[model samples]
Target chain A: MSAKLNATNTLRVTRIASVKTENQTTKTYTFKDARCAKAKPGQFLMLWIPQIDEIPLSIMNTEGNSVSVTVKAVGDATRHLHNMKQGETIGVRGPFGNHFTQNNGNVLLVGGGTGTAPLLFLAKQLATKTKRLSFIIGAKTKNELLFLNQLDPLCTEQPVAATEDGTYGLKCLATQPLETLLAEEGKEKFKMVYACGPEAMTRQVFNLTEKHGVQMEASLERLMRCGIGLCGSCMIGKYRVCKDGPVFNSQQLREVKDELGISKLGFDGNRIPL
Target chain B: MNSNPLSTRLAGLELRNPTALASGILGYSPESLQRIAEAGAGAVVTKSVGLTPRVGYPNPTVVQANCGIINAMGLPNPGIAEYASEIRYAKTVLTVPFIVSVYGYSAEEYAAVAKAAATAGADAVELNVSCPHVKETGSEIGQNPKLLTQVIRQVKAATSKPVIVKLSPNVTDIVEIAQAASAAGADALTAVNTVRAIAIDAETALPILSNTRGGLSGPAVKPIALRCVYDIYEKVKTPIIGCGGITTWKDAVEFILAGASAVQIGTALAQKNPAVFQTINRGITAYLKKKKYRSIKEIVGKAQRN
Candidate 1:
């Protein structure tokens, strides 16, 4: 159960143990990896799809000897991964970067799209520790709002849903309801606010956390070539998202305010506006 | 009477120590460079920048090997034009020397990138002609004495700052190439780059790295790199910056004794944190004290004398 096995920085081939469809563009692939299975929520693994490409994916859940990563078919590697069969094999390297700090008391989980995958894993772990856990899951439509059924039993209150097309609960962006949530709960009510989604949404959540003086931890995604921090593709300010973070606290977030949601390094190492 | 045992000069640029942050390792931006500088690297070299932006190769770019790490990053860069600002910003906060690593397909391109680097306020420009995986440039230009000479001369003429040529170890005769670079006016030479190597996944029956081939670095290449430094120092007059597989103070000392004026740290950073710089510097200082050497310069080529 030592996560150190996943931290070898070398490729280890593992066959897919199971696969679950999450949404239209996203699918959850489970593979048996003792090292990966022990990974703390918020940590990620670099999933290598043979000759196609090697990309970083969030650890969605770990049960028994298996670990799962929820991947959306957004790029070449992920698309290829979606087409992979249950018996197909892929290379993995990690459980890398830092993980979220589990805080007690009232906590809010905000997720957008496949970003909900990691949060769902976290919610399951935090269910027994926290006094109250509330989730705000957002997507373009009800079909895309992920992990609602999985989150139901774990959350003290029913998980809130927000869809842009009004096909679900709140007809607005994920962060739109955050202000009301933070205000209703009062500034001191929620001990920590954890979020993982698009940069824009994370940025809004960050701003809200700052305004309300609530502690926040967020997972950020970037073009990562080397999960060991050698490559500079995932850099934000001085922090390499692969090493210094994939999850960053409020203090660390403040240091990278300039590039957090504003810009990111592209595949060619050019800074592109987010 | 050098008051600091660790202080040394390489190609006319003053450094706090001899340990440098090698190119292609956390040197993509001014902030990362500044962070390493703050961590106590005597000098910092940026990831190689070219005339045009290059996305390099796809993933599976790096893998851990038996004794070292193999990488085929394909020379991904933001291009010198876009990276100039990063150099400019680094100059403002960095207290140590800042070297820009430049690469290109032709001599003219190398010169252009060096010129852009010079204009951007770089203290020196390290010619990255030794990268093994990329074609047309890197080892392609470095392996040939004539081509290497052309690159050195053009880059030397393009920039007033020191031009340090990084040589490929995969050559018929490294000494001849080092001599050629020296004759063409290279101010200093980085003795070696990653040795060309490959890793294959038995499960998939395919090469692990996207490029199929890559440059090997880390503890595995130290002996190879030390030999290059030792050989190049015997024939070349230019200062030698020993690179490849230098992880500890003992390793750094070995390079100095073999005639290296400085050493570059790359793969070691992957294993240890940036604090490795301070650790090495401390070890070097202690070694100097224990040996009763007044300055690290006295140890240069000490083994050669025997």
Candidate 2:
């Protein structure tokens, strides 16, 4: 492994280069680090806020030697991260875990909540390789839908949005339109379907893709401590979310079907319903 | 006939090879253990399970230093009650010996977890009285020979399966503890858990691991671990399972020569993946052929003899 890859296990200190407010609860922080900058879409970084806590965030974007992580102020670590200003130093460990496989042909992207972070990065990367690209984002409200402006320019088809309260393009769950899209487009029309969201949403999308016999890959979230494969916190069935994948394909999902959306490991390592 | 030169026996359990997966490294679930077993480990050990559920410390729990990795995971587990099902599942799929590493705050708790592990179908139980970072349980108990002996005796009485005690390198005299464990009915001993250590960040001026102090594992601790194995081997009749910083077949062979009946691999798994088992096994097999030894048993403690 190169030094950059080896740095995945070693923590590197970097100052926040820039910050962008994505929504009321979410902000994207950019930092100058070669190891993280080299991250492929669907991989994540373990960000450490000194004296506070370390949390895993999806790689939102990368520009040159700079990489960005989108954070939603859900827990203590993220709330602290939200209050920090630019130039504040934090520790980074990865660009760890596997990334989504980019394939040629028409593709569909489904994202919900902060899960859209990695999918947005994937969408941007897939723009050039795919002949036709479509994006679907869902959130509790219109303001919560992420990266509308950025995704619009790259998508070959008009992006779709679903708000639980019907405050946006569609008043249904993100998977609703995805079901229609996959049904109308037919399995042969779309080469692959990619999803990153709440486990339930991704699991729903997986079922849809399976019903249609289309290949799918979805990024999952679990209580993670060691971003490397060592910790079993991220284990889902036979796979460790940190190593085997934060992103898993159709076959991988099938193997973990019983636990995919129904249950996940809590911080205590006990199986708790998702 | 079992003619493989690498085959060895530890505590009456037959192992296809001398390499067993050390506890606390991807041994959480049955599937992960099965994955390691399929990758060619002679035996697989589970992460240390306690009497109750423990969330462990927060992130910054593990970091890679210049020579090795340091971690203070705070003994995370789903509790033995929940983990028993995983053990039951592991027994169904695993072809190699499955050992459950158990820990507790007291002798009764350790015995309780060991009994549960036995009921869950574990081939053996490795007492984890040696975790360096945890307070009041791990090294705290292991550092005291009296306490360590009490814990071992309780666990040994609770289960019929072979009991292996993992020793702490942080102690003043490992041989005393080794002897204590052997006297208390420990069938085997894993000489040396990670050396107690820590890392600090220059920029923040704070410890990198959430717990201020952790244990060090990798190539840096190999010499120290080998010394412990050698020292304990001289005084104790119990079989020794050498662990700490074993990265190559040479390292495994050195531990064997130093009197380790078998070896455990942990930190190296982070760098090498599961293939390290096959790599080390192959190297040991080649070395045995070159040295004209018919089996690994013949070479155990060869260096000690000299």
Candidate 3:
């Protein structure tokens, strides 16, 4: 029962732009739909896999009538999504919840692992606005890091890169470049910061932003059922992250303790309920 | 929306629409009554109430299946005495009529809940002779026409308000049970309750639900409910309140065409969208206007059989 929205139509896959196998367990899928105009950067879609259950995925790219989703085959639905081709049909609903907004300010965009997809979308949107964009991408190793080819085209300044081992740009973490960027500009040149990644990395981002006093927003992850605020499964503390937020302004999280986005978010920052 | 132009009054009560929410699914619990009534649902049914407080089963009163669901909530309630207060509170809050679903194991247990429901200002009472998992009662009383009629007559005798007997779906012939309920002066009949089912842990080979067996509801059981309603509509002279897996307005319209004036939606509220009331309401309004029917009355039981 919906407001005349057919689950089939509301959750249809109109176009599959590209199918890239990034790793053994993960793949990048680009889809375009007229209904995707409602989506924003931090908001997600509930990808319905028919007999299997639905899973939540952040929209990685949004252009004229299309949105892209990068899925990791960790579960049933995600596994099914990884197997689809460029012209296949899938069930997708929403572009649900609030988005990460960028005001007319200098921005620092940070990303990690496959969590880089949303940042890639955000970076292109930010680059068109102003050239003073700081982009940092990181992974555990050279191979584990993804989306380099996509990011190379979008970043005005060279995209900052790092890993735990000395296989890429820096040997520490993505936050290291951000810390250096803060030091070089007397920590005041960047007016805003945003990030999507593992909770640990996001926690570091939120902490650094708190220290720098920059306006910051971080995308959080939580397992969602009805994705529209009915099944009480995707709860983070008090708020239903699906309805209240998946992207929260860093300052607002000061009052929120151990929310689902920061606590239970799995790889790529989607909440996976066990 | 009476299907038969030649309608008979039950115990002197007239039913314009017989589709009512089964007791546990849509209850007059605080703000919920006003919400459901506003949703344009035909009517509201209160959760089952007994003589004392019951905690019911925990954690897994409900389980999911490929088609529907199975739930074994052990008639959890705040008992008749406390429920009377809740019923009073509900009446003041609800704009539409409220039906109280009362359950019991013995003759006096049933009578007590009925008396409490009457005094609490409920518009009517549905004698719940069937709940699959609750031991010592429920379907045991429902499947037997003798017990079914007796329960209806006793509850009807206890209150001046309309009395409806809710029958079990897990029965040989639901029509016989419906006729018996009608003959006993029941004002209406609620066609069915959830069928009993259980799930296993697979690895452990142990029952999954705490109650071992639960009542099935949702889109999965829509067919069974449809069949039950169609079967009973053929024999019952009294109004029939059709329930079971009614989550959409399309489902509601189907029940109406099959000879029910209204419907009750459950399980859908849990797994699909909680904004179910709005969806069902919009669909009903759209269908009504599109079909050019002045009222639900014009199209009820309009299905033609070959």
Q: Which lDDT tens digits does candidate 3 get at residues B54-167?
A: 766543344455556666657766678866876888788776677888889876788778988888888888888889888867898998888876777777778888887788
Error in Å for residue A111 of model 2: 1.1
TM-score of each: 0.97, 0.97, 0.55
Once superposed on the true structure, which residue ranges of model 1 sit more than 4 Å away at CA? A1-7, A185-188
Better model by lDDT: candidate 2 vs candidate 3: 2
Expressed as tens digits, the lDDT of each residue in B1-306 for candidate 1 is 669988999899998899999999985788999999999999999899999999989988998887688899999998888888888888998899999999999999999999999998999999999999998999999999999999999998888999999999999899999999999999999989999999999998999999999999988899999999999888788999999888899999999999999999988876677889999999999999999998999999899954
- Residue A32 error for model 3, in Å? 31
lDDT of 2 by residue, A64-87 (tens): 999998999998889999999999
lDDT tens digits, residues A124-181, model 1? 9999999989999999998999989999999998888999999999999988888888
Ranking by DockQ, best first?
Answer: 2, 1, 3
Model 3 chain B: lowest-lDDT 10 consecutive positions:
B4-13
Candidate 2: stretches off by over 4 Å:
A1-6, A185-188
Docking class of 1: medium
Candidate 2 chain A weakest ten by summed lDDT: A1-10
Fraction of native contacts, model 3: 0.03
User: lDDT, candidate 1, residue B295?
Assistant: 92
